[model samples]
Target: MKYTEILEVVRQYIEQFYDAKEDSTLTFHNFAHTHDVVTHATKMAKHYGLDERETFVVTTASWFHDTGYYTGEANGHEQRGAEMAGGFLKNLGVKEELIQEVQKCIMATVMPQKPENLLQQIMCDADLYHFGTEQFSERNMLMQEEVERKTGCKIDNNNWRKATICLLESHFFKTGYGRELLEYGKKKNLERLKRKETRGMMRKSHIPNSCLGE
Candidate 1:
């Protein structure tokens, strides 16, 4: 099949998979997030001048990267996603080499992401693209909701903000376009979160001992 046709098939399969395995708890890792990542990957691929085959690999990987969330537990979701993507592509008669590349791209999205090549770097950046977009606040809330629902615990807002700040500070965009286009927005988001955290602390400190119900 043509690369375009293959990509269409992958898209359809992933959409249907999400539909069939719908989990309301996965507010942040749903099909919408996958589509966003695919869009980002496509944009990055074009900017980097990836050929048809390379684009296909990255695009397909984006579509299936978080699918493991539906298939099993969140831990090692990347590995599960890679296996699922590999199996589906193998059935479609995709070449073994290309299939491996797709799996590698998906795996590269794991936290503390270690991408060995430009393609993998694109995948990593695309997965976290929202971190640098205006949607960061909304997406971050949804992610926190998903985590709280899955774990059955209320996350402390101050701690959550701290963790998010740590992530924003630690992560760096790998591709040139990503660094140039995303860094400023990411810094803005980080500052916003830090300010919120500070205000939350101040609010708590100003509350009287009797008001605190002690």
Candidate 2:
């Protein structure tokens, strides 16, 4: 089958897979997030003028990169996702070479993303594209909500901000396109978060000791 046909099949399969196993706790890593990653991957692929086969590899990987979230564990979702992609593609008669490429792309999205090639770098940047966009705030909140819901613990707002700031500070866009187009926006978002954290601390400092039962 053509790569386009194969990609369409993968898309449908992933959609159905998520639909069949609905989990409300997956506020962030659901079909919507997968679709967004695919969209961002496509955009970056196009920016780099990737050929049809390369585009297919990156796009297909995006579709399956988070499938393992459905398996009820986020710890090693990237490995599980790569396995799922390989198995599904193998069943579809995809060549072993292409299947491995797709698996590599998916694995590149693992935390502290370590992408060794351009395609892997595209996948990594696409997965965290929101971190550099205007949608960062909304996406970040959904992720926070998902984490709290899954762990059954209310994360303190100040602590969440601190963690988010650390992430923003540590993250860098791997692709040139990402650095050129998204880096400024990411810095702006980081500044906004820092300001919020500062205001939060100031507010707490102004509170009376009596209110703290001291």
Candidate 3:
């Protein structure tokens, strides 16, 4: 199938099937994020001169990577997304072999699961392309908003700082291309987190007497 046709199908499926409550991030994880991943994956594949099949798999994976959020569970969203994407693609006349390959790429986005293969690595990196972006803080804020909207929990400064630190410490880009491209931005984000934490601590500890102000 043509890439454009496949993309259009995916877009239509997302609009028709995405459930905001079950997949809280569904609002933020709209077609724009899918498009971003596709763009990033394409760039990485081109940079490394990936085979045509590998590129296709990654492209399809990018299109459906976040579809699992609609499943209402964060733990296995990738797998669920992959299953949904595969079914849709197969119904759209995509070959079974290619569908499986695309599903593998979709599963590569799961946290704590590193991508061992090159194509998987690219898809994984593309799924998290924001980690190294200059607008990392803004993106992180959006993530915080997503969580708040989904779980109805507000993240205060200390909590947000802690979360940011944990994310920065835990996240690792599988491909050398991502590391080389986004490492510094990731570090900058971490540094910002550290500063925020410090400021929060200082504010909490610095209570002053009213008489001292006079």
Better of 2 and 3 by lDDT: 2
Candidate 1: residue 8 lDDT (0-100)? 97
Candidate 2 — worst ten consecutive residues by lDDT sum? 70-79
Q: Name the Cα RMSD for model 1.
A: 1.4
Better of 1 and 2 by TM-score: 2
List runs of model 1 lying over 4 Å from the truth: 208-214
lDDT of 3 by residue, 50-69 (tens): 87767778887887888777
* Full-model lDDT for every candidate: 0.94, 0.94, 0.79
| For every candidate, C-alpha RMSD to the true structure in Å | 1.4, 1.1, 3.9
Across 82-123, the per-residue lDDT of candidate 2 in tens digits comes to 999999999999999999999999988888989999999999
Query: For residues 95-152, could you state the per-residue lDDT of candidate 1 as single tens digits?
Result: 9999999999999989999999999999999999988989999999999999999999
For model 3, state the Cα shift of residue 94 in Å. Answer: 2.8
Model 3 spans > 4 angstroms off: 1-27, 208-214
In what order do the candidates fall by lDDT, top score first? 1, 2, 3
lDDT of 1 at 28: 98
Clash totals in order: 0, 0, 0
Pairs clashing in candidate 1? none
lDDT of 3 at 141: 77
